[model samples]
Target chain A: MSVDTETVRRIAHLARIAVKEEALEPMTGELNTILGWVEQLGEVNTDGVEPMTSVVDAKLRWRQDEVTDGNYPERVTGSAPDGDDGFFTVPKVVE
Target chain B: MTEFTKLTMAEARDGLKAKDFTSVELTEAHVSAMEAARVLNCFVTETAERALMQAQKSDEKLQSGTGGPMEGLPLAIKDLFCTDGVQTTASSHILEGFVPRYESTVSSNLWRDGAVMLGKTNLDEFAMGSSNETSYFGNVINPYRRPGDETPLVPGGSSGGSSAAVAARLALGATGTDTGGSIRQPAAFTGIVGIKPTYGRCSRWGIVAFASSLDQAGPMTRTVQDAAIMLGSMAGYDPKDSTSVDRPVPDYEKALTGDVKGLKIGVPKEYRVDGMPSEIEALWQRGIDWLKDAGAEIVDISLPHTKYALPAYYIVAPAEASSNLARYDGVKYGLRHDGKDIVEMYEQTRAAGFGAEVQRRVMIGTYVLSAGYYDAYYLKAQKVRSLIAGDFKSVFEKVDAILTPTTPSAAFGAGEKSDDPLSMYLNDVFTVTGNLAGLPGISVPAGVDGQGLPLGLQVVGKPFDEEMVLRVADVIEKAAGPQAAPQEWWKA
Candidate 1:
């Protein structure tokens, strides 16, 4: 099914991205083109086939939950564009 | 010393061991070439000072006969791999000017092998797009030109920079990551060799994520032997990466016996897609002939799910990408656009930060994974992915490896497919099946197309069988002979 402008607007919001109102119609066209191409996958008969997440069929390996790395808060937070109070700071969450 | 830059990685390593020239000289040759070829816009960042310092250390080690296998070699790194203290952009504005506090597992392994860094190379934004045009930094101009045609072609993405740098002799070797056809297709376009190891062979620890399941790091080099040496250093189990396979990393370089006697090479019937250029088809035929002449048995095979791979790949890749990219929400690192609140801030930052292609993918991913459409899109794609992998599994049981064209055609002019995304995605039709199967695949520059642009042959092998893949690639390379470099119009 071709994507509509309204759905495109909703998708941008769901993805936490902002698409200008002016661009949503064109973006809808682009998404529809891609979707139109991928819709062929629906034709494949995948009855009872398990969805393969990882190609290598190995048990998920686990490890001890311990702090093996630390003490580099200065370096860890160095790339942050905005941070304060010894942590990553975003815009005010509460009014 | 500038001539040293023209030598293959293996030759340069031997030359450095013989003390014919210092590592400083080798580094200087490539560093100077990088400067001269700036018109290509291949490198996103140049580590000249760090390279010189590392080269000096390598020289000291060589003096004492203590340097590692890849000692004194200078190589370009695709920006996807984070280098400590060096800005790693992955050619996306979202991560604009983001310098990692740590290094990626693959680069760390290269450094431990004494490979000096030339710098990080450019790539398609977040390793998206078929051509390098989507880079926020600007497109990487292919160092290649069509025969008698002055139009500059694209070095295929998203590892275009790595392939171009290696082909242009700006670096002896370069690191490239293939999520789809990123590494192999670019290698084909530039007339070099690139090998994408099995999915879990190289650690994805610090590299920027594209599709977690499909992303893999590999070597783009001037020769199959060089690709082997680089892969040997780059592959190994890493505890830091949970998906990294826990197994012994074979000595890939040493395993290059270059003898394919009695080996069964499968030529899949389904690969004869409609409208394939006659030259590409002939090139595939030549690959079959060469393997047969080299005492390898040619067998007809069928990978019936091949036609569905590209569509499945597009869905699966973006679905994973939408999840992986959610972290860049203007909170932790990189670019941040302020807004009324946290949610609006995320919206604004992502809108202004991501390129159009990236945004398009994110939108597609979000739509497909949404509540009502999940099973129809994302889940269906996953089941199709299983069928595709099963095709390869059965084929591998019949033959040692499968041979197919690396790309449907040679490199095209930049912006040629920018208006049409489907055309761009089709460039990977021949290569994406390997990634979907999570197999080791290498592209060897086998022949030049009618336009004199280089074309490549791809070898897909069993999981963790990079040794076999590289060996078969070597046989093809020997039959193909060395390819001449494109004229350096980008040179000063």
Candidate 2:
């Protein structure tokens, strides 16, 4: 149940958010408070209770699965922060 | 006419039909009001030119005898919905300058019904905050206030701007997307009617995803009938959205008879949480008394997993949001911070683009979904989600609908809970269960609290049974009686 500073740092790294060391204390405190609130769920006797997944019991409704979206590439790529030749470009990965 | 701000959608539609006033006049009046009330910061982007053009087109349609119920009606859209060529930020820096090329199915449907778009309203970043403070733009001020009180109250959020705008008559009706009480809470805070329709009733194809499973687009308006009219236009099957239900859209406006005679209403015992303001409790009881007076059976029911809702929702929503927001890395659509390396760029852009609260959620979501913790957190939350839904199902077997306070308290002053995130999250506690169950929930103004701010009572119905939910809400809205006309915040 303990979330250490290192764990919090790792979480920040994974989530791609920057956190200052000074703010970590309060952030940790707040996170622990939230976790404590969530921990209240442990009190319920869920022994025989089934875990609910989706709100409705229905399965993922299937579609035609056809490749209908072909024309909007220009529009699709237009919103990208960086794009070239109809493909989104990220910082060079395999340097 | 006193002012366009005082006119309801029904009255405006009647006027348009009678040719007593043109859609152009209505649109112009709203535009002037919006210009005058700019200090409320209700709108993120005002599409006056587009709205005026649409209104003129609507007038032409009426002249040609091809008008619909929503024809010539002006509405503000939440920034979360993608409108073609309009900035759709979801009130987050991550989406800054992101203009969607395609329109959301909900907005498209509204446009097809001839509803003029006034602009996009501000919201909590990614619909995360209960108060409007989390918006990347700025806090949206409530358009109404108690006489002689200068304290700015939160209009409620992440649909606070929409609610305030509609409540102040900046727009006739506004679209709001609720992932967890975003629409209803704000509506309650602003003393307007907001409904979170049964999941799948409206398409989510172009709504900027917050939590795909729980998110639903609904209408926020000054009255129940206006909400019904807007909902009628907004709800339907959308082939592009996989989750959209292909059910027949009902005649929502006509269904509002303000009568719930012999209806079965359930009062959940667990919702009476300790420390709930006595005034809210009294307002809830008053709602029950009113329902009983309407010849309905008021039965006490138990939703055993009610307490588990907030925790489970926190888990599920952040999990889904983490996945949905992963697309916002520096490389994709939105702001990109320049860097020599990909990792640094990703970190920098996200850090720069996402607000503090958003980062907090992404961290929580990432932790819960991380390896070695997935089974204990995310998976466990999903399981609990089912139990919560089952609790509702079992209760519905015994009662027609469940009623609870839409929010724990009335509109708190802006920044009251900005320092305490947990207290802010508690605002949606009563409403999140409906989202977890995929049941329809509506917030109707119950009465004013001791502070003279509004309190709302939520009516929850069986899944896909929005007609019954609105019917129950309409009954409460009428019985609770007319609210004092919202004070004009723009007047000096």
Candidate 3:
């Protein structure tokens, strides 16, 4: 699986991490190297094997839907990069 | 007594309880040591004021005979563990200046047991790198060095600060989370004791998520017994983390029988990787001899999937990391770079926030999980992960624990392998299998290489069998006997 600059640019956009145009070629080389190494997974025979989602197989316990915690809105939003009276501020999405 | 900073966690605990020395005095000593060891860049944030306040409270409890299990013990916290009202960055620019409103469950457990916090220790950014060099705060210098070499060796990561601080006696112990070999590898490198308890043994609630399934919080201490004591307090069932195992927290300190008689120890033949340092092989052999000398049975075992652990880990960890990190899209918290639009803002924030290694992993993860490659890459990697875990389960059924070298070699100098990710990934070759299998593992300082840098022997046990792991590690520590790093030059 050869990763090229276009793939790097696409994934970088998909991952929502901007990559400067000049750095794309270097990123492609590193990403290709990593993907090449990971290609070793192809050697393992995994026929009929279940993908291990959780190492421990316990069921997720269902809890009451009511509010179990969190009443302080200030604490929840205090660390937001841009915040107002009670909500996070961002580039206007609805305009 | 000698300098209070020099006391082990056990010694400090006893001395505080006996009124021989006060927690305030102990905290003061470590605070001074922390200040002096700034050259190591081990601690990103020092909470000396809060430490003193907590110590005063601990002293009152000690005086009244009402102290908790970890009362008055000062320790360092890896910044990955969210500390309420204290900046927790995971040593990354993305989380820079992020003061978590709630404490991570593992850290809160320690504080509830009366452990005093010295500060937040540095780590590989987002706990991703092996050699701590990836940390935005800068690399933590290993207190241990090659004889006559002052080039500043790395204190392995992403728990390098915890291991370095503990080894340098800046703090008696520290909390470290292991996704791959974050805790054990650094512990081995710094000549300290670090244990990664069973997956879900320690609560992950409020912790900055790395690779969720493999990520686990554990203790890094100077002594095996101290590791046991700290692990006990740090582990428990928390409602906040559904993955947390609900079993009762055992008195891990009591499990340190210091005797491995009648125990079946497996020496896995597969761990004898090609081109390994002779010192590591010799240390593994020495570990076997010591266990045998203590009356434990040594049997040869094989984990064929071991060879694939590293490659499989890279895929799975980064894939999950890509997913977990999506939440940091310039909205909720931390650093945000402004853009003309919301999507561009996210791209700009993340691009400026994460380091190069982090960006690379995210790109790889995004590619693998992308539409066309999901089945061939991510799904196949997941199946390989199952086989890796199965390898351990089959072996554990036949033996009580497995013994191997903690890392392929002792601490390497900073920037030694940073340019090549594969070489750096090899640092976790011996330790990641345990995480893949969700087993408990500990690294005990076994001996030193020709350069006098410390080498460690790893003991891996069945899931939820940290007791056995600690017991076996205690035997190794006794055999190795209280190996502390030679005078920390950073203190000068």
Candidate 4:
């Protein structure tokens, strides 16, 4: 139930945010306060209550399973910051 | 020619049909109004030129006797919706300079219905904040104020701009997406009608994603009828969006006759929180009284899982938001911060792109979805989400609709909740339950709070039962009477 400074740092990294060391204390405190409030749910007796997933009980309707994406390679790649010859260029991975 | 600012969408349509006013005149008036209200920080981008062109086309169509229901009507779109060749930022630095190549389904639907686009309204960055303060552009002030008041009031958020623009009569109506009360809260704060339709009712394709499961685009307008007309135009099936309901969209306008005879209204015992202001409590009682006068049966119901909704939503929405926003890496369609290495580039880009609130949510989302914590957090939250929905189902067996305060308190000063994230989240407490359960909920201005700011009552309904929800709201809206036009809006 407690969010330590290390956990906060790791979460910040995963979220791609730059949280300075000094700010970690405040972040941890805030996270703990939030978690403390959320802990109120533990008091509710939900034993044997079936977990509901979606509001509508309907299952996902199936569409024709086929390869349909076409004619948009240039358009799709056009938004990328770095692209070359219809492909997205990422940093060198095997070096 | 009628003053375009005073004409509702319905009135405008009727005037156009009767040849009392031309589409061009209506469009020009709105454009001028928007220009005048620029100080409110309402619009992120304006489509004045394109709007004139569309209005001209509608004039031609009307001359040819081929005009449709919404022909020549000027509609403002939230900047969150992607409009081809138009800038669509979810009010985030990440999307700076990003213009969409494709139009979102909702915008396309509006266009197809002949609704002319006025422009994109501003919002909280990524629709993350309650007061609209987190928007990169700046805060949007409420157009409404007590007769002599000069102090600014929040228009509510993250649809603050849309509501403020509508209240200011900058646009006849605007599209707003609600994920955990964004649309409804703003609508309430500004004394307008906003509906979050049953989940899966509106197509999400092309609208910027924020907690995909809870996000729904709906209409924010001055009247219930305008909201109904706009909702009718926007709701439908879309194969492109996986979550869009394939079922037929009912005629929402036809269901707004203010008739709720024989309907059972459920007043949730849990919604009467301990600290709720007495005026809000009085408003709740008044809402029940009005519904009774309309011949609707009122019954006490319990959504025992209500307390769990805020926590469940905070966990679930952030978890989904984390995954949905992953596409915004600097290398994609938005702002990118280049770095010497790939990892450094991503870190810099995300850090530079997202604002403080957004980064905070992303961190919360990422933590809940992390490997070791997934089951304990995300999965557990999902289970609680189910129970929340179940609570609604159980209550629906006894009543046709549930009523509660749309917000704990009326529009607080813009900076009141900004510093406290938990207090800000509490703004959506009564609202998130509907999103979690995927039920249709509407906010109708009920009364004024202690500070004389407008308060709203939320009517939550069973899934796909938006008809009953709107019906109950119509009764409340009638009893509440038309909200007085803010005196400040008329100055100069």
DockQ for every model comes to 0.88, 0.69, 0.88, 0.58
**Comparing candidate 2 with candidate 4, which one achieves the higher lDDT?**
2
Runs in model 1 deviating more than 4 A are none
On lDDT, the leading prediction is 1
Off by over 4 Å in 4: A67-69, A83-85, B146-149, B489-492
TM-score of chain B of each: 0.99, 0.98, 0.99, 0.98
> Which of the CAPRI classes, incorrect, acceptable, medium or high, describes model 4?
medium
Residue by residue across A1-95, what tens digits does model 1's lDDT show? Answer: 78899988888999999888899888888898899989998789999999997878777799999999898777878888986655888877886
Clashes of each: 0, 1, 0, 1
Residue-by-residue lDDT tens digits, candidate 3, B139-234? 899888777778899999999999999989999999999999899999989999999999989999988999999999999998888999999899
Write one digit per residue (lDDT tens) for candidate 2, span B1-492: 647667889889888888888999999999998888888999999999999999999999988889987999999999999999999998988898898898999999999999999999999999999889989999999976765898888999999889989988899999998988999999999999999998889999999998999999999998888889999999999889878888899999878877888888999999999899899899999999999999999999988888888998888888889888988886658899976788778888998999988888888888889999887777788778888888888889988888899999988888789998888999999999988888899999989988788889999999888888888898888888899867775856
Per-residue lDDT of candidate 1, residues B328-399 (tens digit) = 898789999999998899999999999998988888888889999999999999999999999999888899
Q: Total clashes, candidate 1? A: 0
Q: Which CAPRI level is candidate 2?
A: medium
The lDDT per prediction is 0.92, 0.88, 0.91, 0.86
Report how far off residue B232 is in candidate 3 (Å).
Answer: 0.9
Residue B459, candidate 1: Cα error in Å is 0.5
Return the DockQ of model 4. Answer: 0.58
| Candidate 2 displacement at residue B35 in angstroms | 1.0
